[model samples]
Target chain A: MRIFGLRKNTMQEELKHNGLYSRSRQALLLLACFLLITFLASFCLGRYGVPLDELIKIILSKLFPIEQSWTSQMETVVFNIRLPRILMACLVGCCLSVAGVSYQGVFQNPMAAPDILGASSGAAFGAALAILNSASNRMITVSAFIFSLITVCIVYFIGQRAPGHRVVNLILAGIMVSSLFSAGTSYIKLVADPTNQLPEITYWLMGSLSGTRMSSIGFVIIPMLLGLIPLFLLRWQLNVLTLGDDEARTMGINTNLLRFVIIICSTLITAASVSVSGMIGWVGLVIPHLCRKIVGGNYKYLMPATIIVGATFLLIVDNFSRNLMATEIPIGILTAFIGAPFFIYLITRKEKML
Target chain B: MSLTTQNLSFSYGIHPVLSGLNFSVEPGQLVSVLGPNGVGKSTLFRCMLGLLSGYSGRIMLNGLEISSFSVRELAHRIAYIPQSHGQSFNYTVFDMVLMGTTHQFTPFASPKKRQIDAAQMALEQLGIESLSKKSFCCISGGEQQLVLIARALAQQASIFLMDEPTANLDYGNQSRVLDCVKQLSQNGYTILLSTHNPQHALFYSDTILALHGGTIAAFGVPDDVMDESLIRLLYGMEVEFMDAGKTRLIVPAQGRGDLCFVGSHR
Candidate 1:
């Protein structure tokens, strides 16, 4: 039966009449375009510069075998070093941003981020331990990912034990767990060899995509996709989740189960991102807020918007990180330098909403 | 769906909240639960919604035990509207209303086109379609309450349990909400709302359920159940009923020398 068709048409008509709807649609399109432009620009503007035209031709030549005019060195730089790094930046950005948005919704706290459950700190410690033992790069990534998940699981169990106010309990438990892991990370650094192992550990903790390889990208991509698909599909349920536990439960949602699933998925994404790219912070926390300004806080649109915006944001920041100096600055340092001020501006301008 | 509770009792550890509360609501009836603060009004509503377990009694929805129904089944039959409060996010009114359709879709599925249409129709039913694009946080308290009601409407449930729906609203908003409640009852929706104001119960409700000291102090038609003595017993304050043409107004009774007129020189 066509019972709901009439109302659907009317709703569409009303939505078209409303300017915000079209504006948001345009904003999403603009973000998608921005992401593409930034991605290509990131590939072309690295230290070993490949012109935009050459970059495009190289990309197209992969699909269609055209005679290469550029030197093989240029091709190697474009394909081997810059491409994987750019892709890793995009993947890590996408992962952290989606995880942040989910954490905020699940906690019903705008200030929440992926690190709230000590995932990053725990991952850092794991990477440090692996480096201390002279493990392979892949082993370090694996250990980091596993430790991040374990840390969040520990925080969740601790939070569940507290009596009242589940959200508050979880936040408090997260802080305690985070501090505990942070101390462990500090201890690992203190005992490592001063010249080599210490510097490596410190650099990893600072977070970078300097040594990213195609192999490491494969490790992250599967877990990231596995985590993101559920979040994207269940964005509507995430909205109900933000309404608080009691209301969501009454709305026929299994709040505890949904919360557990969201936590696990978000932790997987965050852990994978941190393992591949080290400890990039603020992307998860700030990207979602920026997207909220664009998309008006509906997770249905906000989730996908966060993915695009975050990927684009980190790509732009990474471009600056590499090109702004002779020595490549850590992307984490650049993000914090940029993210904190931008966040301050957002807060001061929209104080009432905050 | 009709709702009935027989010999319902609930306690929190050593403290009892509701005890031996018996009440039945027919379809298309507007019942107002009246009590002072901490009188188990909200507790009773939670019990009815199956939010609180370990309560001993037989609470039935359409002759089916409430405990037998899953959370989703209960949601299909009954919707709960807690007191309106600020949200952590500034969701659009349309998005806020769309949340009511959560129960209709699977956990991994987004709300489809039909559910969106249901939310829009709900907004139209409440006569707030123009506010669809506005931020829910930006709206007035009254408008927010109406949006919440629209959300409940979108749920397509037969029974509504509201806990102090108009508690924080201004006088005009309170009247508007009460009017909406009356209209819903007239349209064959069973509604049970709790309030501290007995006048709302007097003017709007078909039946009054007065809870006092963890028990049902009074229950019946409003006219038969509400009286000066009952108000005194419920709130520990003496009151006088004044005739207002066809309706009655409640006023606090004055003790000796309690009523004094102060003149302004200006």
Candidate 2:
């Protein structure tokens, strides 16, 4: 009843008026519970399997000392290995989903994602070049970050005409830029040392959190979190922006300025995520949409819910990647496998993704 | 505040759309910009609102240079309603109308209670408060236009600039919107509206600016701009005016080269 108090009343009112089953409250609660359960399942089951009871004990031991034989090794698995991976999954999930929501609003297109604007391809190319040059790990991430920023700047410069009427044109420009960078990546792969660089690049493209460490997570968390903060603060403005340029302008918004700020912020968050974790697609395209189906389109509710659902979805995927077979699978592969069918379902709905 | 554009010249790239266009409307005055299509009416309005730059002249709000005002300052002074805008997604009528309050509310804040009350009042002013919960895209063209007008009203600006306010409305709805415009004028709001229908201009507007090929061919009262030879030269059709008591009617002559009044005269 507490969970359903304000939200259920709003949903009932929305349903009475809109008549389209405004189950935003019900859907959000269900998603929250499912995400929590999934997160717990992710922690409990992995290649180095800790049973649910053991997992609970491990969690509790951090709070209160529990004398056990499995303490040291359990600490290593939970704190050293799994914690960083879970946190990385959470960071990437929040980055991608928030970026997706922002991109959709900026372009006024339901299907927009970070990759559409060449952020993923540019980061992949940067990392590939770094690997080819035998660069340091930090340099590789730095290069990816810079290149993603460059890609966004180029796309915005080419697509903008006059002011904030760049919705359709901007997406078209992003598609063109994305293809160009993808072609560059292919060329780099072709000429690279096949035994070492080619394999590394290929694996990076497939994406995995296997290599994620606390240090690497530290490198990404600060920048992505900083960039995400502004986005959360401006969520309502983003919603107002989706009403089209004229309406937004009429509302006394300097729409062009708002567009520029949002693009830079979301791009930074996206580029930082890709730099650390490699090319993880579909989470950006799919998670925010799934959240929208549950939380309605208001960013106040949608942003937090999308972050939670996305983190849970990816953490579960990361767990499956490690434990599904004898060899660790790439997170991207699992996402595509699951996302394709769900995306197909979304496409068949009355309002297909623009 | 009164709105005026003095010797306002605006061009898109090589071709000029409005040149040396001088016009004025006092506070509480309702003026119409009536001309054939592509006569630079919207361009003129855009220049006045500072939506378009690179113009070679001046637009003044209450005798203050429009160029001196920031976008927010201009928005607070004047509200513009576009001819017809596309809704790519579903937003409720209340949400749509509430957008006009963005000037007063920060991006971090939702509209306050007072703002919501103002929006509801604006909707009621247009007699469509019941439709506030409906999807904006689901409404009829006239209803959408009214909602748009309501949004402009919610801005609480003293001046209104509307492009083709009656284009999508039927006769009855057109009259209703015009009546709303009339009421706004009576309530001490200044209005500048663009329309293709000269009859609407004659009926609702005190001043008419006849635009021809990017320049003001004629300007003044409706009767003055609606002259016989000037209308023929501007629209390439013979036209005449007939006085019926207090009302003057604009009637286009039936055949070519026959600028004669065929209607009953008072």
Candidate 3:
């Protein structure tokens, strides 16, 4: 008589777990190629179109000495215009998705988005306040980032002291604090000049990468890397965190410390992403979910997969936002348009809840 | 090879849960702790695992205090097998088992070849390697319990802290899990398992420790320490002892003649 259970081994299982790795690895490679293609193609698909050959020469000129076959107009658009925007789209996309996935794991809640801890709302209020005060663009970004961190700090402090399950309390605190900052933003919008500051605040609130310059990348890359690298390294702990707090602690994980670090890093990434690009939605929430569908839930695969898919997805969406109409569509609108429907499809198509 | 807690007392906001609790578990013994819900069984386990660090008194492993050891050092000695996890991710059984080796990894390092082999060996030891490729959420309750135990085995720890390992299983699965647990002690692993069922302790435990009212109710060899009064004290229920060939059973005393079979059971 069988004491435990039946054993019928699959051939893939016989491959000593490399099969899972290989499939995810192959998919990641394909997605990386796709992301690269999207990156290059975004450089070529603007209103003042740079042809593929011209785009290639423009990129190669940076590496090796080449004759200036491209016109000054094309050079200005590529170097000062499209390049920064493309890089910003990719960086913001990657950061948001990574932060989103990290928050989901840390909180053990699939519904935990990048801004679930009030970072975006804080950044929004900061930007609106800055625009009202007539602060320069750089100071606006800095203010947004600072207030974003400060908002999450307040939420975390309150959440820690709230009398219930920590995760639930944190989420509840996030909702309340988010509304508080959003109300602050509404008040700032109420008093600002409608023609200039009000429109600027409104447009920024809707999210755009339109004015991203080379300097913008320099501002964000440091904090983004600071946040992203630790998250990438701590992907293993992210998996343990998903098992809940007690089990993770028993597995020798310093759960509270690990969680604090994860929260701080995720907040850094989210705050930086929002500070520059306004509040771009859906890429963070949807890209990770899509990656989970492609690769299984193991963070080892999911983290890298989300990075590639998120960057590619945002690049493609940003391209459409620019080229779709004479007036550039705010990326926030496009992402919600694309992201909400796709998220619904994912939820409905699968028997499992993501 | 020994775990001893001396005058270990814990409280939540001044309402004490476990007070002056003292017990020592021997090496390679399957010691079952019988206790009712909210009688501080879980709180006691938390204190022992070092999750609740605000507790008073000392818990020592072998000879040293548990608090002195690093998290990794403690994990290398004592493995915790939770009843089940609240996993929303579709991690495979192999991935679930692989997490057992997290304690061995240095900071920023993922599991390597040595850890992978350990996880594989753990599944093989439990004879559940076939389930390695299956999603953890898709497995049966019994199979999930075995997988959790396999994870503990992968930790390579001598002591296992299991709180109600069979509390959620079917009758057949419960025995199967107990049989697997019993075999672990035979193989020289110290196990401290908590249960609501008294018979499980009588049949499988080397020693039974019953907790009630913030203290040790009784602690000794299961057969010698257990009686009708003790059962009543622990569970607040009436039970009669039925003598078997070698062991005995605790059956609920009195009849249900006042009530019908179909009344508001659930």
Chain A TM-score by candidate, in order:
0.94, 0.88, 0.94
State the TM-score for model 2.
0.87
Better of 2 and 3 by TM-score: 3
Q: Which pairs clash inside model 2? A: none
* Order of quality (DockQ): 1, 3, 2
Q: Candidate 1 residues A1-354, lDDT tens each?
A: 486987567677556445546777788999999898888888778667788888888889989998898878888998889989999889999999999999999999898999998899889989999999889899999999999988988999989998998878888988999899889888988999998999999899889988888988888899999999988888888999999988898888988899988988999999999997898989998999999988879887899899999999898888888889999899999999988997788768846774
Worst ten-residue run, lDDT, model 1 chain B?
B256-265
lDDT of 1 by residue, B1-266 (tens): 78999999999999999999888999999999999899898889888898898899889988889989888778888898878889989888988888988899888888776777788888889899899889888999999999999999988899999988988999999999999989999999999999989999999999999999999899999989899989989988788999999889998888834433455343
The numbered model that scores best in DockQ is: 1
Categorize the docking of model 2: acceptable
| True-vs-predicted CA distance for residue B215, candidate 3, Å | 1.9
What residue runs in model 3 are displaced by over 4 Å at the alpha carbon? A1-15, A66-69, A347-350, B254-266
How are the candidates ranked when ordered by lDDT, highest leading?
Answer: 3, 1, 2
Cα deviation of B121, candidate 2, in Å:
2.3
lDDT of 3: 0.90
State each model's CA lDDT, in order. Answer: 0.89, 0.80, 0.90
TM-scores of all candidate predictions against the true structure: 0.95, 0.87, 0.94
Mind listing the fnat for each candidate? Answer: 0.70, 0.38, 0.54
Per-prediction DockQ: 0.62, 0.29, 0.47
